[model samples]
Target: MSKLRLVHCLLFFTAICILLPPIAARGGHSDYIHPGDGNSSFHGIARHLFAQEEPRPSLELTRGYMTNDDLEKAMKDFTKRCSKISRLYSIGKSVNGFPLWVIEISDRPGEIEAEPAFKYIGNVHGDEPVGRELLLRLANWICDNYKKDPLAQMIVENVHLHILPSLNPDGFSVRKRNNANNVDLNRDFPDQFFPMNEDLALRQPETRAIMTWLRNTRFTASATLHGGALVANFPWDGTEDRRKYYYGCPDDETFRFLARIYSKSHRNMSLSQEFKEGITNGASWYPIYGGMQDWNYIHGGCFELTLEISDNKWPRAAELPTIWDYNRKSMLNLVASLVKTGVHGRIFSLDQGKPLPGLVVVQGINYTVKAHQAYVDYHRLLAPGQKYEVTASSPGYKPRTTSIYLGDNAVTADFILIPEASSRGKLLRSNCDCSCKNCGQPLLAQFFPETNNGITLTLVVVVVFLCFLLQRRVRYNLWKQKQSSRRSITV
Candidate 1:
């Protein structure tokens, strides 16, 4: 063959190799094998390489031990064994068409509200796969040991555990960080009115399914499992001037109560510490525009927690056992804590006489109030029924408290905030500053006629007309070029 032709052929082969899947394109590496291949040496080596670095020895051993198939099969096997205790269903499909399975484990079956439901979602991001495996293991362990383990029996009997083992299956399949459309599922929520990129907002099927499921189910408390920095991020991300993030809502007492429960259970975890010197503002963590936890709190009315499970990226299979050891108790503790405090309520608008769309209704204390009884602080921005609050409030409104009692099951409360006439009048008066002695002009002089509406309409018309004219010009140029080419061809 000619040297030039040979070079071209070689380049073509290289391009083909680059385009192929990694498992197929790479010629040399260990062959993909099943976890149960019975080769102890291989399993040991794999475990060692992916071992977790946490001080908890038990969890580090089992951290990176299972694959996607292992988890799926385990879920199926678990359902078969515990048919009486749990039922599995497809909540939604992932972007890659994988089923987003939700395994409902309960003591009795009927409307979920008949019993308390605790939601545990794992692997929202594909890179953090351990939660999926751990959840399966937990399910299996609970079923298998329920007869013997009193704690397991107590949990199964009292709480209905809803386990979403994989939230972003498309991301999990390729081991990518984000979903198939490269959107972070955690940040793709509709909590605010701002427009989202059409491609991204509706891009990931997994996220869509999750949102639908959450809308239908009324959960008391929920946790989303992720892997990266290990910390339990709480509500009301720090303020601009504050050194550390404070739970800003009136229900800060409740926020602290929940945080304290989580911290007490996972005392060894970094999130156990109180607001201190090194902590970052809760809201400013990564500056995410819309997040699942925030939406859950503001819109879903659930006390949601973002649980960062591990520090290792793609932890080794062997590390699975270790991860479970440390987290299993913590996860169980959250469920127990929710059962202990059945706190629940809805937020409403003070002026509109309807549910507020987006607000922070927290169960905390107002700094100005005497520190005696626990009272939830209300931020003016909370969405109705999206957060757990014993009390609710809005701007220019009197705060309302509910007598709803929290327990092992669900509780509901509606807030009716009374608008403050004085506050409303002050807001309506636009030129109250005109009363300043230095300003000689009357308040009415500072006010302009309502010409803004006409100007806005005119601007819209002009822009539309310009766009139409540009489209016509471009089409005419294309037509003229085509006509000229046809004449030349005839010549």
Candidate 2:
């Protein structure tokens, strides 16, 4: 080869290396959809999309949007910084090699082994990304401000928060709606529908990881986050048939209470209202089979909820400030409510009044009307010989609730919570003032003296602006270097 030709090739290769650094840094040809208009500012596009017409009180707590990479870093940073408060672990790995990370935040380390723990997961779907951001914010907020904030202190001190910030990491990496295998992890559970050609049961690693965690952890109350809807979807989601829509199948009253807590948290976004106006009610809405919520309820015997965060397909980054405003308080309320109640029971029936094994009973006592769901594991703690105000329900029988004292930590409480002969009970209007319409009453109002320690929303705005400045500076430096290299090559 001629020396001139060699020189030309070397120069071309150098130019390529200099100009393509951004592409290289972005993880190699991944289709990460940034929220932007005209391909300029993804953040601006996100902001405009989630922009609320009427300002809400709670929408001001978000500081900024974290990219997938940033989120990973934040998780690492949090665990490292607050090692005293949290323990980070990889539940599994995504198809893209990102760890499915879970940060177990607690005041007491041994509590998880001793007592039943509650779990909260965010960003199961890649599109609904706010929960991932929010959970991080919540974790950070609690760690930073717990000493000053009573609510934060109470939560960390009491309940052990097992948070999975990003469940569908493969989906998150590519910004796809489903996992890398094109399977919706939510619908990939081992249920009655399993072995059917359509079901992706135990197929995806993500599903397997979550299922394994549930089997191992013994979670009391759990929730998964999604978007493109504005309601908290509870169990029996597979069916819309009213005939099969009674509160509880095996445990009527307990299901009702669970449903009530979910409803309360979201200010009572009614199933009827959701069906009338929400996305899932539409004929065009994607129908999922063998989802996580149903499997959790039936197989795991865990009370779980699917919290649909936003109505937008991809909520705008710019609107995150506003979105967090509405969500932060509601999230806090939901977590706080879970630890408030003491005695929770679910009434059920047995064949010839015999004790049925593996029955779930939830008893809610000192019920205060609140708009958030409280966390309780009525199933695992129930013993053979303990006294419980039980509401027993089983499939193909009349639902029943009764008071019984058991013997020697035994399993199974059999009582018939009378099922309505017809599904004609007057729909009671929720008297709750809390966010969720179905929550009975605010437990905080009863116990902790209410204080006007409003969240420092202003701090969030300042932090967000600082993040914006930092990002802009980084982009500017990259752009400047690219321009300089282009000029040099031209000369």
Candidate 3:
């Protein structure tokens, strides 16, 4: 509270900010335990633990294409036309104030279903506009074909597919790789290995919007569309040591399988000579920091892939239809893949027979997926033909594990957790808090003795730091006063 202390505190904060940039440049952002390490029942996300843009292909010839404004209108139109099957919503606005619109396609639009949810994000790189065009085509195609096409029907009935055609419309409008502020939207997420972009203010509006959207929604599986390459990229986006190498996450096998599904479904992606199988580990392709793909996997409990759908960043607008055709099956298959593979189930309370929105973990996999709060439904994707030990756990409830051989078709595993009433008593008597709560003391006081200790220690640290700041300020002021006195005497 002293003037001297305040000055010192101000200096300390300024120093912290000044020292952060270079380190952020090296790592850039924000546990991934996908695999490679040993042992199961949830491996560590990361072993070390610590962790294009196309040019003026031109807006002049953009007649047949949907402008950002057109895209918004088209989205609204689709929701209206497919009123029974679809609805429109916005995540947030872009830096240039473009509403980031999303069209949700499902049997029951805007309603919560125990069904698995999948999202397709496109046009992350503004100049690689192929994704945005293709995604709109995809949304329309499903709407028109869902009646007759079994694949389309399957997707509409089984999955809630949310399509965000353009994440960086400002970047797209300018025909650049980044958003309006020139920040690469794809590279603005918090990376796990290097904690760069961890500060919310430093991240761009588009990035913040995506983060906020993830916090509100639970996506079982999702994919973002990118152009300029013809391969599917999976995590770990960067290695632990920041080296360029083939690094894999805990569910490396599962991710590879997912990638393969897209590549093979595409007309010619599977024939790529650059990346065998048309799939490359993200780091193997290129090392990047603060990528959206890795962050989705790490924090959102969402299985995400970075799909490079086109080799040409900006092919002629005429190629849009062909590109959509090429990617149509892949897109539909990828969404349907959610219902066709992995483990699908719900959790419930044994006593009340009520749903519990608990978390599901595969024994060997490092990631955890949470069930929908309303439906208590969860969908987990793993490589088919693998045997996995799946475990479901909820707070204050007994955890349960089950083993199953997951085949090509989806397998259902429901859990009923028993409530554990004596956990609090066990916690107080545990080694972490050895002494029993004194009967003579207030119940609240005895129960939270460790919390009280923590507060006391925190106060002590704050006081000491304040004193140090005050001393430094006092010394600095004295030095200034001495210099003034010396000048006056000399005069």
Candidate 4:
């Protein structure tokens, strides 16, 4: 081939290679894999040239692992065992028709109230089963320690916690990352920057189930579990350029604070030598399109984190208890952070004293928290020990903003908006009480009670209009006089 032709061919091949998914997330997650043969992929050969930084310990996948049927049975038993504070329900079914079970833990299990609700989604990737296992253990632990443990009692009575242990049970059964149809659930949501996942029909059943769940329920904040790296990941998960860089969402500080809480609470997550605080912005680490983390924050109004709890995605079943113990504090602190911090309140209309479904936003933060449709209530999560200017807005009504020092306690930041059209109506209502008999009485009668019938309102209005016209005519005459004087030719 000629040199020019060879150059063109080489450039095309390079573009294709760059676009292909990684064999596995380098030392992180392996979300993408070779479809035909998993062994077609391999870790970087450089590990052979240089000693591997971290040795891979022997992992026995089936030793203590629960099968799909066993997990379902465990969930069913938990509901029966702790029927008062927990209820077992299915959000939707997976592609294989396996019911996507959820265990809701609250004092009033399914009743809707003013309290905030949180959700924990696990096993997004079929291969990462640790999250699913840990979640079931969390539910059982809470049940075992309900009022006996302070934190457990607080979560049960104050917050509505929903736990979906396995979203991709079919994938878990097959021991792969993708679901039965081979669509990666993490990359299957509707993206704001791209249209690849926008077509609803193209979405997987698991993705549709999550989308429908968010629509029916309002979650204050949530977290999804994954494995590969040990760090707390926050949004915006993807960047506009699709390049690797630190791209923070509007609520960067708040997300960082939240991530720090989880890491610090964990046994040794905060001691990580790779990540600074054992927390990273998703885009900073790597950019993935159609990620659930960004979609939850954008569409569902839920502050979500992608947590990589273990270096090995599938650790030995014997290590499961140790892993759960390491993550227990982080999980509890994250859920407790919902009720322990931030500002929450309902928006109201000034005229009718009714609720207004307005938006709550922090001044410097670009994110918006939406009020619930039923009660017009909003829950905004922010880091404590800071002064923030919070604003609330709605259509056709004036937006209201206020500054408050949000301490450790949850501050009630309610707003009352005045509709734009109400000004004229209020003025008219003030002028006359809409009484026919009072039509002839001047509005000034309120100032002078004895002149109640002295000057008819109609006569007063005519006199005022006549004075306005006369004043305008006098001004015109003065202008004509000045113009004529200035235009007159010198004699």
- Best-fitting candidate, scored by lDDT: 4
Cand. 3 Cα-lDDT? 0.75
lDDT of 1: 0.53
Candidate topping TM-score:
4
Show the lowest summed lDDT stretch of 10 residues, model 1.
Answer: 24-33
lDDT of 1 by residue, 341-459 (tens): 43332344322323442233345433221111112211122222233344554556667654333333333333545545552233121121222242222212122346995566456
Tens-digit lDDT string for candidate 4 (237-318): 8777767789998888889989998999999989999889899888777777667999999999899998999988888888
Instruction: Pick the winner on lDDT between candidates 2 and 4.
Output: 4
Distance from true location, Cα of 136 in model 1, Å: 1.4
Model 2 poorest 10 in a row by lDDT:
23-32
Cα TM-score of candidate 1: 0.56
- Choose 1 or 2, whichever is better by lDDT: 1
Residue 81 lDDT, candidate 2, scale 0-100: 92
Count of backbone clashes for each model? 48, 59, 19, 0
lDDT of 2 by residue, 227-290 (tens): 6556655545443321223232343334444444444554434443534322121111222344
Which of the predicted structures, 2 or 3, would earn the higher TM-score when compared with the native? 3
What is the full ranking by lDDT, best candidate first?
4, 3, 1, 2
TM per candidate comes to: 0.56, 0.55, 0.75, 0.77
- The residue-by-residue lDDT of candidate 3 on 1-491, one tens digit each, is 69999999999999965653221111111112122322332122221121222246666656577889899999999988999899999999999899999999998888877788899999887777888999888999999999999899888877889999999899788777667766667667877876655667667888888889888888888999887678888998898876678999988999999999999999999998888998988787657777899999999888899888887877888888888889999999999988787887778654334568899998877878888888887788999887888899888788988887787677767686766755454211111111223222221222335887768745643554344335433633532332221111000
The candidate, 3 or 4, that scores higher on TM-score is 4
